[model samples]
Target: MAVITKYVVERSGVEKMTFTSKAEADAYDKMLDTADALQVLLSASNQLTDEAQAEALALYLAQQKEPLLVALGVKKAAKAGKQDSEEQTTAKQDDTSSKGLKAVAAGHAA
Candidate 1:
């Protein structure tokens, strides 16, 4: 009964796909900005230096941001599922109370 939402990221002529909770989406965007900075540093260097390797590692982490967001979505879904069950229980209790009140008004219950 729960609906999943999809988000898309377009960068460097490639379209990236992701699904995430709102918080995760925001975090991923911030991480992506950091990744972009690393990319710029990597491009400016002509040699495969230590700095370039470090930048590459940062870029890899950035690419993983989307997967991390998806993991967040899984956790969110579990929490949301529990919340939905609680809401349903409350609704059923309300219905039962209403039915009892109607029966009492009609002299069907003491």
Candidate 2:
């Protein structure tokens, strides 16, 4: 059997994690240390209120913003384009049927 180790991120005395290897444990420890440092900096900076800490923590977890925004923008544009195409197709069908009815009416009048 292999020994499984754990790494924890402690904030306000709460710790949580699991690591399969020493390297993974070390990496997690480093991440936790960095997070602690960032929290200290944030507190010192006076940039976040108590209510804003969660958002700050989330930003730390993700590490960067540009890539996230790009991904979200791509998904939003794709969704909008699909909706536009569906609406256009429905409008075209409606117009075709309306024109066909007009043609049939004209033939009957003649």
- Considering every candidate listed, which one attains the maximal TM-score? 2
Computed on alpha carbons, the lDDT of every model, listed in order, comes to 0.72, 0.67
lDDT of 2 by residue, 18-88 (tens): 65577876766676666566667667766676837844674475453334445767344556778999999
Tens digit per residue, CA lDDT, model 1, 8-98: 6656767654646666766666777888776776667655557757677677867776565557673345467789999999999999999
What TM-score does model 2 achieve against the real structure? 0.40
Look at candidate 1 and give me any clashing residue pairs.
Answer: none
Worst 10 residues of 1 by lDDT: 69-78
Candidate 1: where is the Cα deviation over 4 Å? 49-56, 61-110
